[model samples]
Target: MKTPFIVLEGLEGAGKSTVLQVITQWLEQRGIDYLTVREPGGTPLAESLRELIKKDWDERVSPEAELLVMYAARVQLVNEVIKPALAQGRWVIGDRHDLSSQAYQGGGRQLSKNMLAQLSDMTLQGFKPDLTLYLDIEPAVGLARASARGALDRIEREALGFFERTRARYQELAAADPSIKTIDAEQTPEQVKAHVLAVLEAQWPS
Candidate 1:
């Protein structure tokens, strides 16, 4: 049987990194062989794309260009890293995935879901994660947490409305998809961690 592909997603400072540590620890305790990778990365070419996409450029980068570049990196990583690992029976834990594009580009950039779906079909075919943990937070709260970490990246510097749109899309999508479990990230870290672990444990018990 194909191994599972699990993904964590959220707005900036929704504490995805902290959630990742929880997952890795859980996997290690169970002696599960797993590989962790971040979107727009996970391969040499993809990593470069990650930098290009995240860095500030003097020229205005079109939404179409941004979307395409993101897909390119995802394609490379999916083909090279994720697919291979799953084929060999290792669980793949992703920091972000296609859902991110669906929210960020399709929502924040105001691109149509149809357009995003077409791109997803062309690049990813039908492959998708078995489970997704979506940490939901208010944009302002999340952004404040993000900014506290220091310098804001290109996407991080977007106006508040952009993230508001993004968060709305995320909630809409999560509500429609049963495979996605939403955690209230505005709560204390312990509460958020408990919610995440509860979902994970219930989903895949030892």
Candidate 2:
């Protein structure tokens, strides 16, 4: 049986990681064969790139540079991690994927959508999530949850307005694609997990 490819996407503090953990446990209980990984840092090379990208943000870093680096990391991750795992019939759960670039770079940075699409076409070769669970939350609420966690990183430190733009972009993508399911993340963790499980059951009912 071919493994299902699942990707979890959302803005910072939208409970992406927590939901990931819950889904992993659910899969484990079902004895589902799977592997979990995250974008921008899945492979060793990608992790190095991740560090570079996350290190103190530079106002000098051009939007193009940001986009290139993200795709570069993604290319490496696909070649080294995602492709191989799926080829072996292991379901792969990604913490974040290409939609992130669309939200953060194309939307947040206000880059040209044409350029972004062209780059994605050239690099990703049409790889996409079979199911994408998007945890939707208000920018202020999400940022407050993030702030309570700890000191913000370079990307995390971006203004609330930036996250608002990112969140809106996520909604637009979910609206455009039926494969993407939006889940309200303002609820408790257990409630959010239940919503995700229901989505998976509906999509992959046996």
Candidate 3:
């Protein structure tokens, strides 16, 4: 079987972590070697950048700076972790990837998509995940879940409008791209698990 690069994308508290665990178990059962990676924190430098990005800052951070920092962390992780793991013929399951930037920065922050495109081209040269499972959830529900978890991070603390825009862009992108699959996350965990397993079986029915 070919090594696959699979990415899980969604707003916070959209049940991505649960889906990731399920996928990990499936890979173990199939005896396929796999690596699990989280965006902006898979490498040393990238982890530092993740802290910087998520930390609450006393001073205002410009949207451009926020976008660049995310890309910077992404470039580090891609080069140091994801690419190397894939080169070794290992399947990779990513918690998040470039799509998050598109949704969070481009849509939530209202940054220019052209700028995002330019940055993506410059950093990744059109490289993309083989399969993306996007867990779609209402901002209100997702936010309430996130809030219940404790202190929200910088991005998670954004206004409801920010996440609303992010979810809209996620839906828009999923509709436009066949490789990006959308999973309804508002359902019960059992239903969500069934949908995720169905998607995986359909995509990789070995």
Clashes per candidate, residues 3 or more apart or on different chains: 0, 0, 0
lDDT of 3 by residue, 43-104 (tens): 99999999999998999999999999999999898888998999999999999999999999
TM-score of 3: 0.98
| Model 3, position 52: C-alpha lDDT score | 98
Candidates sorted on lDDT, descending? 1, 3, 2
Model 1 lDDT per residue over 59-142, tens place: 999999999999999999999999999999999999999999999999999999999999999999988999999999999999
Better of 2 and 3 by lDDT: 3
- Models, CA RMSD each: 0.8, 1.2, 0.8
Residue runs of model 2 more than 4 Å from their true location after superposition: 57-59
TM-score of each: 0.98, 0.96, 0.98
Residue 146 lDDT in model 2?
89
How do the residues 78-193 of candidate 2 rate in per-residue lDDT, one tens digit apiece? 88888998999889999998999999998888888899899999998898889999999998888889899998778888887888888888899899999999999999887898
lDDT, model 1, position 155: 94
